[model samples]
Target: MAVEVKYVVVRNGEEKMTFATKKEADAYDKMLDLADSLGEWLQQAPLNLDDEQREGLSFFLAEHKDALGQILRGAAPAEAPKKAAKVKMEKSVATSKEGSTSEKQAA
Candidate 1:
């Protein structure tokens, strides 16, 4: 006989998820909390939203909290870092040149 430990997240008297570790359960619970708060806030928006739409928008924002946080903090969306962009561009040029030479050889 073996005993297993599990963490379960329950919401409104229903079990939402089960996790092997408490950390994962806590993270999921936190996201749900954020979604709940966002849903309430959306109710105050001028645009009319049906209940389903508000719920969906709330979850979407909660799932992308990192990007939303940056925007809310007055930061513009970040572009790819210059060094990485340069490396990607170099790789693309090298590949295109290699393809042209290969085509010439085949011709």
Candidate 2:
């Protein structure tokens, strides 16, 4: 049997895309990571953002709210005055762990 190599993009418990080479896959992954970073940074500190940039960022957050939430939620510290926010953060972490487990299983 011949061995085949494929780079896969998995999202929300599903394989969304496949790449023929690892470099291509890495590029796509880096782009996604950059997008997440941009979203988080914009949310945290959006000083002096132009109208078009603000609109694009808003659209990106709206389109990828779930994924962006997971990224930001994980990075955020557990220090909030409201108990509900703290509890929500904990729940998000739990769900994130579960997702990591699923990814490990898939790998």
User: Where does model 2 exceed 4 Å of error?
Assistant: 1-4, 11-14, 45-107
lDDT of 1 by residue, 26-84 (tens): 99999999999999999999989999999999999998897787678666446324545
Q: Please give the range of 10 consecutive residues that has the lowest summed lDDT in model 1.
A: 75-84
Q: Give TM-scores for every candidate, taking all chains together and pairing residue i with residue i.
A: 0.66, 0.36
lDDT of 2 at 46: 39
State the C-alpha lDDT per candidate: 0.91, 0.71
Q: Which residue pairs clash within candidate 2?
A: none
* Model 1: pairs clashing at backbone N, Cα or C within 3 Å: none
Query: Which ranges in model 1 have alpha carbons more than 4 Å from their true place?
Result: 74-107
lDDT of 1 at 12: 100
* TM-score of model 2 vs. true structure: 0.36
**Cα RMSD (Å) between model 2 and the true structure?**
15.2
